[model samples]
Target: MNPFDYEVDILPLSVEDGGGFTAVAPELPGCRSDGDTPQEALDNIYDAIGCWIEAAQEMGRPVPQPRRAAA
Candidate 1:
């Protein structure tokens, strides 16, 4: 039931563009992170999602549900 369970998209960045992977949780606006590797980007995005949910909860905002994965 963790909010970080939302579907994530990982994209690779070019060397001139800082050379890292970017992870984004599509269901949560502005919830994303970048890292030197794909795994690191995923890990960072999980933390970002948690923080985003917590902030939303603290402000009495509705937290969005995780989108089901495609079959």
Candidate 2:
């Protein structure tokens, strides 16, 4: 089976919400998700990423792959 090795960065910011902070992907606008805690936010962002990718595909737009650094 092929591996899903693509990258997606999630940034956890200090901006306060109702009871917790938010996590977002700067490269993938509208791909934001929140949680009650840092760990939860990280987990939620993964789901948000999946949804974002699906939406992009359905819209017939190519989802830009995350950039990587050369070693």
Best by TM-score: 1
lDDT of 2 by residue, 1-71 (tens): 00122343444455553667577766677777788777787778777777888888899988876654422
Every candidate's lDDT: 0.89, 0.65
Off by over 4 Å in 2: 1-16, 69-71
The C-alpha local distance difference test score for the whole of candidate 2 amounts to 0.65
Q: What is the TM-score of each candidate against the true structure?
A: 0.88, 0.71
- In model 1, residue pairs whose N, Cα or C atoms come closer than 3 Å (at least 3 residues apart or on different chains), thus clashing, are none
Deviation (Å) of 45 in candidate 2: 0.6
Report the lDDT of model 2 for residue 22.
73
Model 2 clashing-pair count: 0
For candidate 1, the TM-score is 0.88
